[model samples]
Target: MGLARRIAGAVFLLLLLALGLAAWGRFRAPSAAERDALELLRVDSTPLPAKNAWHALWLLDYIIPAGEREAAYAQDLAQLRDRAVAVRAGTPVPPFRKWAENHYAALPKLTDDDRAAICRPVSQCLAQVRTHPEATRLALTRHADRLAAIAGLAGMDYLWNDMPPVTAAPGPDIGDVQALWLTAAASDFVEGRQQEGLAQACTSALTMRRLHVGGNDALGSMITARWAIEAGGLAMDMLAQMPDDAPVPAICAAAFAPPVDADVDFCEVSRAQWRGSFGSVENFPVVEHGAGGASWLLSRDQTRRLAAPAFVAACKADVRAAELADAHLDDAIQPRPTPDFIDRIGNVQGVDLAVAGVPNFVPYLRRNRDYAATLRMFGTALWLRTLKGDYRTLAARVAARPASVNPPGSRPIKAGPDGISLVMDLYAPVDGERVTTVPLPVPAS
Candidate 1:
């Protein structure tokens, strides 16, 4: 054959070999047990029976940090040893008997070397249970140490370090879900190895924050806030496990710091004005001046006209409270605004008054006829009434005999609209006295 044909034959032979190798690999993939042992470092026997104790221990590991893992494991192991002793001493392991049986039954299936490896420690553990139950507790400690060593050998500590930061558009992504799954897998591994799972959780949280908070077009602020709260809660739980006297590193302490923009106040004048104007005129009756008699009389309409500004002021106050609640951080305590200060001009009583400015005539009656219809259209009557109710309840509670009714420096009382007025405090509380108060700008009536 010519040189070109010989080269073509050689290429064809190589391609054929590659295809054969690929087929062989597809057929020779590791079995489930082999794959699991390779991946998790232990065989998951008895798939039908859930590993309850193992799962609980895993959850504990996830919440706790690596530095505290061995200690926590030792404590848990001691308790388990005690329980096991009680079990062997005719203490019916009714709830756990099935689990114990399954675990023991699966043990014989392990290779002789694997059996010896696991059995040596377990036998030692059993002996301790039989004799010096208290001293046998150390077996748990030794087992934890061994597992930790194995994890270290497997480079498990790199799990979190190797993960890339998550960044995606506001919507969900399969990649993000996969990253979370991997984090969970790492968490499970750490738990199985009796290592700390907090690091895994923390890494996952940071990834979530990056995906949900730092990225543009990311999740809503509310979603980000929820995750932040959950992450902070987890950190707090871990911190709680440490002794109060234990010296906490500055970085760790800083993790618990509240997020910026925790407290916010916003004022909108236009909406407040509209609401107030609508409220004042809402329940009033329009009167028409007929060709009857020219007589100037103060009618109910005059009272309502005067109260329009007050109604607007109350609307402004309600808006402010809603804004405050939405923007305030979980740790913030906001006092309910007092009803007296809700509106400078109108009291709750004026909201239902008739239009008062015009002289009493036929025109007044005509205008009054449309009052209910206008009020219903404005949408302020119900909202303002609710605000009034909230203020009243808050006022009653706060204005009670003692200033210390709810306790000093406690969370601010939340008021529904009916009792909303109780929340206002123009002046900061001083040493047993109301100091000089700053006047909040009132909207035009």
Candidate 2:
């Protein structure tokens, strides 16, 4: 009986010790897990959510070619992916999804670097969808909503701040808005929302035009025209859903037309100027000057007749060009020509030559000259002229050109007839080198 009692007591003591150790471990394990969760929450609180996935994918895509040290970063990204899965599975994890959404919504308020960072996680979520397929569809759906919300928030921020101020003066703010809209529309399109993208792009284009007309500056007008062209290009690209084809004018006609408050005559004249100076029309007849000084219209010939003297003469005769020149000549020509010369020219032309506004021809010529150089460099003019004889065709030709033509930090100026000139400067890299050219095309009609 004594032995039995001693054995039982020993067994009881061992059981108690075992229970205590188990309790201690249970308490310590949660503290460690909580610490990790808190650290993750700190990272999630910042705008890093946006950049996490993108950075990871980019690193994975080109780390070796990029010559960067990214192995550890890649591993961290892998770990994050696992944690994100846990969060998605409703494992009582921290509010990573909500945190991401909030961070994304606040993206535009953050700095550019912050915005970039926020994009990363969204990209990773997308990548997850691709690999896991249907198993992760629900999680991806939620992530998509978060991404869309973030995009909407960023867009609103742009509309509020980056949009052109409603001032009496003209500026590039309208163009900036249109650009932002295009970016948003592209995001939507990539997410398989084509119709939504098209609608947004169209609306943005119209808004840009409306804002453009309110301004009085010639530069402002030119800038707005360029925006219209770009918006039209985007519409065509999206509508066609092809890489090579140009968008028909009808697609953008509703958006391109002048608003009710716009000057009808001025707008018509501007459109005509666009047609004459650049191949703004896809199928319009080209106006050619005959040897007898009579003008005749020519159809698409593809004979390199775009540079004919008659075509040049027609461009010179353009009323808008003349008006722009008259407006801006004084400012453009330094040490202004003698008053007598201006008066004599004025008398011959029955207009005040000395009177100047901004020259409309300046922008047109500048764009054309740059177009010519790009055509020469790419050897794509013939193909472009043959495919679709329009401004879109010309733009595509420019887009498809090799990037070697214009390197960084180099500016090229090409001069045309009558002191007209165009300047080309490099922007961001397209493939490997910067593509710098004025967005203009050889007049097709």
Candidate 3:
């Protein structure tokens, strides 16, 4: 009897403790600064839920990649996976039957032959890209036209037709957005179609920029920024491979140029918002760090205010890093600070950075994009001079700074086996070699 009474008493004590902890958690308040910071952090928004237009795309089987036929193939795949159950029961699977009927009805009524007919031109163009460098420009033009047509059929033409600030209706398959542009740029450049390559590459860069521009949605914006970085890098690569005599119009360079002021302005606005989010929460619910499972405990706001401001600084750091990278694009030897914002931003808490209007990925993406564009532009300039005269002339031209041919760290250009090279370092050394030779095309024997 006594033991039972003791057990009841212990249980009562435990219940009382739990109630006390819960009450404390509800009342714990953040400091004034913390409140302001919380308000600020809350400024960035989630992407608007645009109507999914992917179903219309799925209606065209011939143009879409197999991986992208999710809606069209889902029902069929599920039925096949569950074939044994249906066979054993010798009964029609009602759900699969309905799904299959609906899916098949919606799919385009094109036979295999019809599908092949639609794809023949595209296939031929791609084959030309693969086989004959002599026919590159024509092949690329045909291919781009064919792709544009297919994109129209798939309801994705807006990506090419529209500019930034337009939403992809039934959002684009974000995974596949850059694939075609990257391929086009590489193929065109290798085939000696410099103008075409530049056009395609620039189009890709513009597309990426358009995808996220003017939207405060962090994830969507960052995704666009990442693709922009990739597209910009590929654009530079194409430019670097162009023959010296290849014409470079002002438009080509302008394509890769980002509106730096707009980006900086956006960051400033976001940082201000992150600093402001903390003002509304009276008490922050502190999670109790203990062994008997976690519980919230309300207490006097005790969070150190340093992390909030530090996080905002980190966001600003990412923008500045991007700006620095852009400033060096026309030169070789990309200038990087010894301790970059990327390094500092990485050390910041992920939540703080994300909430503070710059995710950790932004700095890394911006830095790489900037460096790639700069290096490629430098290579292109040197290659052009090499075509005009001998290696000595190339060195003299670089020294003279006839164009924006300055090297990073003011590293002097040296004569290479073929033409000239910069014995320069890159950000985040690959294979630990700082000096690399930029090979120029050899003259016809």
Candidate 4:
């Protein structure tokens, strides 16, 4: 009986210890890493320059010696962090300047008619504009300088990013408008400014594709690229049907060419997800008091440690998805489903949640490729419209199928009703026929 009682006492003490640890974890102070991450991530509260290159070859320049890029960055970051802390604690900080501010400030404010005109689809509105050109014309006339300024953005390479919004974070800073660059180009097209509109459209596509903002784990870049491609689609639809064979001007030539595909990467996105995994200390209380939010059962570092393996697994999966992206569009790559064992409802330790949250980039990648191929096929129509050739040459090219524009026997460039339209992965068949019948423009006789 004595031996049994001793064994029972030992078991009870162990149970108490476990409970004590759990309670402490559920209410522990934010770790140094968590504090540092918050300071760095919530950047708008401080005075660092734009996170990326600006219109005139700009990045936040740190003043340390060569071969010490990371060191310089760290030093600058430390100063910035200090300033942020001081400002938040009611201390005076030095004034800061950013070149992007001037450029944005110069943008023409949108008027009611201009906003409404931007909402109109350029292709459908052409006939409407020709007959009743008052509204668009008014917008065009009223905002001529604005139009010019917006068009000039095409010449300047820039990436518009507000960063993966911690807006849901406590006392978050206001974010910039997300789709202004895209909408600006669309508005230009809607207002009947063909040349400038094309230039803007091309620039928007190239900007997103060329210099994709790397840090944020959001698919905003890929999604925005598709939006730009769709805008190009709108352009193609408009140009193909136009009765007049408008010449692709010397300046607008490059804009008509199909844009290159963006390099597929989700590693940075994974890091962002990982970083945000640690719920902010400020917001933790709200989570703790409100519901069964992890108070958390593990410290921030412990949580990160537990979650790192899963993040790596998810990132590796993304890399594989990127490989499959290069394969044929219909190539089947199964997505990694969330592990079944993890409990989401009261998951204090988010071990597999990050892995599950990693987006399936496979579908989006194929769409981007199809859009690129379709744009290339549409490029042929643009060529025929502007670069009319001898009948023999034109007929030969047409007869050869879009092989003149694409490789022989590509699926998307297949023949359509009005000589050659398009068909892609996204295009669905109607009445048992899979085709998009676009009215390819005839060069004026």
For candidate 2, the TM-score is 0.29
**Who wins the TM-score comparison?**
4
Model 2, 1-445: lDDT tens per residue? 9999999999999988766654432233223433332233223112212222223222221213222323444443454555545643445543322222222222222234323322132213223334444433333233443334323322211111111112122212121233334555555554677667656555555544543433223344445444544554454445435233433333245554322223111332232332332222332233336784333222221111111211222123343343322222222411221223322322222112212211234334343333223323222222332355344433344455443333332234332222211223422222243443222233434
Error of 1 at 366 (Å): 43
Write model 1 residue lDDT over 298-371, tens digit each, in one string: 23222333433322221234433433222222211221222222222223232223233212222211221121
Best by lDDT: 4
**Each prediction's TM-score against the native?**
0.21, 0.29, 0.45, 0.55
Question: How many steric overlaps does candidate 4 have?
Answer: 1
lDDT of each: 0.29, 0.34, 0.42, 0.44
- Candidate 1 regions off by >4 Å? 1-170, 174-219, 241-251, 262-445
Candidate 2: Cα lDDT at 405: 36
lDDT of 4 by residue, 67-144 (tens): 443343344345545655564445776664332333233335556656565434333444545554566566656656
Model 4 segments more than 4 A misplaced: 2-112, 123-125, 160-164, 168-223, 241-296, 299-302, 305-348, 352-367, 380-411, 427-439, 443-445
RMSD of each: 34.9, 34.7, 12.7, 10.1
TM-score of 1: 0.21
Off by over 4 Å in 2: 1-110, 114-176, 242-251, 256-318, 321-337, 341-361, 364-445
For model 2, give the 10-residue run with minimal summed lDDT: 156-165
